[model samples]
Target: MIANKSLSRLMAHVTPGRLLSLGFVLVALTGAQAQETAAPPPLAGGSQDEIKQFCTNIADAARDQRYLLQKQDLDKLQTEVNDRITVLEKRKTEYEDWLKKRNDFMKQAEAGLVDIYKTMKADSAAPQLQETNPILAAAIIMKLPAKQSGLIMAEMDPKKAGVIAAIMASAADPLTSKDPS
Candidate 1:
């Protein structure tokens, strides 16, 4: 009963302003303590300088590992490029072989055509040559014996024969032929 009376007397003496001030003080102390605990603890054994030295020691090793990985990537890219080049070379060789075969076939066909024209009479050959491409007609005439070519030209229309002759003359000596602009 005496303790209760003393607590009541103490409460009666404390004003609202004093109680508010006490509450603010308690809050401030609690905040300060929380801030102190929030900070990270220092390393258990190593000093700051030792930790820095350890990081420095590993720097070169880390850089070398990174370089090795980059080199591996470059090597893989180079291998791919080489493989593509090899494939392209193979394709080029195949194309060259096909071109050669085609050229050989064309030459044989031209030769056979010349032979057929050689056996034909000028009257029969002239009309056919006139109907043919001028370049091809000129080529055929150039390949024939001079006597047969003359006979064929004599039998052809004058305009057609002149054009064929001009083509033959230019083909025979391209350097000397004047461009008929």
Candidate 2:
């Protein structure tokens, strides 16, 4: 019978050496699968820096890959090159959107700065009023637009502007701020 012949053939190949080799191979394959399922190492760079570096590297790799194309391979390379360009374009658009948002926030901040400058200008222009607080003067100097601050420094007496400038400068520098005694 076919079954009796098949059993005889299977028994003929079941040597002790072959069985051990098969078992070793099975264990090795399982070990390899376990390694494959293990988590990848964490990235060394932080988020923003990592994104920037990844984009730069992708652009560079694409450039390098393009240069390796032959005249006969032009069509194949063209598709690849186009795909790279599309990716770069998307990254550029995302960066532009972020920049626009940042600019909008800055614009709002600058407008508020202008309002504060206007009030300070009016108060400082008055005849009899005197601002006694150095902190108030420092705040006023700090709020002035950078160009306006430069112009005011040029227009006013150097000694008075210098004092206010020193206070504002101190307030700006985190390292220079006063420590509690």
Output the number of the lDDT-best candidate. Answer: 1
lDDT tens readout by residue for model 1, 113-133: 999999999999999999999
Mark the regions of model 2 whose C-alpha exceeds 4 Å error after superposition: 1-72, 121-151, 155-181
> Candidate 2 has what TM-score?
0.31
* lDDT, candidate 2, at 90: 100
- lDDT tens per residue, model 2, 1-181: 9999998998799899988988999999999999988967666658669889889999998877777666439878888999999999999999989888987986686577557565555434321112335555556445666765565555555666677778788787889746532
Q: What is the alpha-carbon lDDT of model 1 when measured against the actual structure? A: 0.93
RMSD of each: 7.0, 22.8
Candidate 1's TM-score reads 0.59
Residue 134 in candidate 1 has what lDDT?
A: 97
Q: State the lDDT at 84 in candidate 2.
A: 100
Error of 1 at 160 (Å): 7.3
Among all candidates shown, the one with the greatest TM-score: 1
Which residue pairs show collisions in model 1?
none
lDDT per prediction? 0.93, 0.69
